[model samples]
Target: MTPVLSRRALNRATLARQMLLERKDISVLDAVSHLVGMQAQTPHTWYLGLASRLSGFEPSQASTLLENGDLVRVVLMRGTIHLVSPSDAAGLRPLVQPILDRDLQNNTMHSKPLKGVDLARLADMGRRLLAEKALTAKQLGAELETHFPDSSPASLAYGVRNLLPLMQVPPRGLWGRSGPIAHSVLSASGSLSLDEMVLRYLAAFGPASVMDAQKWCGLTRLGEVFSRLRPDLVVFQDESGRELFDLPEAPRPSEEVPAPPRFLYDFDNVALSHADRSRVLTKEFYEQVRPRKNFAPQVVLVDGFSAAEWDVEDEVLSVRAYGKLSRADRAAVKSEAEVVLGVYGVRKVVFV
Candidate 1:
């Protein structure tokens, strides 16, 4: 049997998957496939994910992508809405549809108002309106109220998000900006197919297990389709003995691979890997995930484990290591972090 990847080896591989090894010139769509997809929060960390990678990525660009119909904002991977290219969404949405539907059925936010409703008509109407022009969730809710006046706008909005394949108009997701998320109809969106999308996912994030796909995408049984094409793929297993799969030509560097410091966007695939995330994060780092007044934590990497919470404020990026690091590793982190100071053309990267 092939040996399991040691934690350090896994860290480098994770960095490679996440584009931390070296920046590539790929477009947003290609980058999206790599690392699977970015973790999304409305108008916030989502853009940071795109910003941290895309060299010229601007706060307005994410919105522009959405406005031009190149991207879609919808709940995906881990059941949170992400801003992804329409082509990826087309293929991925179908894969996660059941999980999303099941969640809606179980959640009171949508279940209550959508109960006994002709959901098909509602979805169609919502789709048509979005296709006509961009509208905020509130605006869409107002329109839905015109049809179902008895339903609360709040409830109808949740139901529409739960029912229709909606994409937010651009500017909503552009970096450094935040506001209402507008909607577009996925059916009206011309993008890639399910087969192509599944291929993209495998190409970018594979050597991964089925559960990793599910955890990253909030979908499962993609391997059902993948199993049919098993001949076209190479496979491996983790230390826990769970099966893993990857492409034949993909990179699988040897353990003890040297890695530099990486600044991760919150909830990016790097952090989300593994059912047990000890490969990238330890028990202590997980505790820090608890929010301090809704502020997103600035996570730092030491060796492989998440060693501290950090921040970029006052034109300075601070590294607060939770534990001590070896001198060489500390220098490595400091050197890499110093470049992040150049992100906005600043010269200050402070360590706490």
Candidate 2:
């Protein structure tokens, strides 16, 4: 009989892999690589995601890497920007190119204007333009327009962005600094085969169903990839009988392990990575903290599940619980919030 993993067990496994169970003492590059890169569409707040998962993490640790080109923010999984090592920036982009291709073909805004345009020629032009220096989307678009006069300049730029691997360069993602979005062509080199990527996914966010991996990467038919890797993977059934695949040696700690309070950033991958998020985010919590007008609220996790929503304003951290928390749980939450406040130099924490 296949072993059954209760939701709590699955939650613990995920927390362990994500470095949320305990802060890991590791370099920012290693942490970023180990977790397979962070979902980092937002500019500054994503630093909070790292702060929650790494010991003694300073924003400068990652910011310095970004400025030095050891790390980058690029469109990868699900066609969203991710903060990744330069290697992954090159490797994962090719594997996920289909997602961008599909978007370019079907995108409601940019597809029509790009019809009949020579995408290969446009990609060549983009590469040539970027070869000189990084250029903002607006600047790149204007330059591409001079060659392809029939296409909308915005659509031409959007097409090239989807067609090629581009990295959003520094001063843009740096902490406490800001700049207009700019792009440079990412150097193409080594790439990850589907087999290797599937294994990496299981290592990072696993004991998961095929759909979960699909959800995380925005790729389809991974059921075949999972099928091929099943021989080496340890299989388990979720409470609902969904088949979950994980690396044989991957951490699957007992459900009884203690989970400390964690404050997740608004776009943290933990909340967004899985097809069924019940392991960490309950439907009730989702209903209470659901985004308003597409604005996702950063959440507080207590006992390894989403328990509250939090934000900082005017140097004050404020938390609003979805339901009542025990006195101890409330204290733990406050203590964790204080740590976050201290990292950002905020002075106070308040419960709302």
Candidate 3:
């Protein structure tokens, strides 16, 4: 009989893998790599994601790496920006290029203007321009317009971005700093194969199904890869009887394990990576805090599931629960909020 993982059991596994069950004493780079990379579309808020999973994490640890070129924010999974190591930036960009290509072809706004444009030539131009020096999209678009006069500059720049492996250089992603969104060519490369990438994904976010991996990376047709690796991988079924794949040695703790409250940044992969988010986000809570106008709220996790939405403004961290919490859960949420506020240098928290 195939072992069945209940929702709570799956939640515990996800929390354990994400380091949310307990803060680990790992280096920031190691944490980033272990989790396969964080969804870091937002700039400084991503530091909070690290703070939640790492013990004694300091913003400078990652900031220095970004400045020195050890870490990069690039378009990879889902065609959104992610904070990743140089090697991952090189490897994943090419692997997920199809996502960008499909987006370019189907884009409601940019596709029409980009039609009939020589994308290969545009990519060449973008590479040459970025090689000389990093250029903002606006600047790169202006330069490309001189050559491709028929295409809209904005559309041309959008097309180039999809067609090339451009990374956003600092101080754009550095903590406590700000800069224009500038692009530069990524010169790093990695030989990580699709098989290896899938294995790594399972190591980080698994006991997940094939759909979950596809949701994380925005790539389709990975069911075949999972099928190819099935003999080497352990398999289980969720309560719904959906088959879940995992590394043989990956930790899947007891369902009754106590889960500490965790604060997540708006774009944290933990909430967004899975096809069925019931492991971390209950449908009722999701309906209560569903994104407004595509804006996902930062979340507070209680008992390993999203229970509230949080925001900080004017030195006040405000938490709004999706439903009534037990007295103990309320205290736990408050305590975790304080720790989160300390990371932001805020001194106050309020529940509403």
Residue-pair clashes per candidate:
9, 0, 0
Model 2: colliding residue pairs: none
Off by over 4 Å in 2: 289-291
- lDDT tens per residue, model 2, 1-352: 9999999999999999999999999999988888788998888888998999999999999999999988989999999999998888888998999999999999999999999998999999999999999999999999999999998999999998999888998899898898989999888466789989889888989989999999999999999999899899999999999999999999999999999999999889988889999999977675773547788888999999998888888888889988899999999998988886576778888889
lDDT of 2 at 32: 88
Which runs in model 1 stand beyond 4 Å of their true positions? 47-67, 187-198, 287-289, 292-296, 344-347
Instruction: Please report how far candidate 3 places residue 167 from its true position, in Å.
Output: 0.8
- Which scores higher on lDDT, 2 or 3? 2
Error of 2 at 182 (Å): 0.7
Of the pair 1 and 2, which is ahead by TM-score? 2
Worst 10 contiguous positions by lDDT, candidate 1:
188-197
Model 3: how far residue 308 lies from native, Å: 0.9
The number of clashing residue pairs in model 3 is 0
Candidate 2, residue 224: the lDDT equals 95
**C-alpha lDDT (0 to 100) for residue 269 of candidate 3:** 94
Q: Flag clash pairs in model 1.
A: 59-174, 59-175, 63-170, 63-171, 67-170, 75-81, 77-217, 78-218, 87-192
Cα lDDT listed for each candidate: 0.67, 0.91, 0.90
lDDT of 2 at 255: 100
* Candidate 1 lDDT tens digits, 38-130: 657555555556555666655555556665776667776666776676666665676667777888789876678777777788777887777
Q: Compute each candidate's TM-score over C-alphas.
A: 0.85, 0.98, 0.98
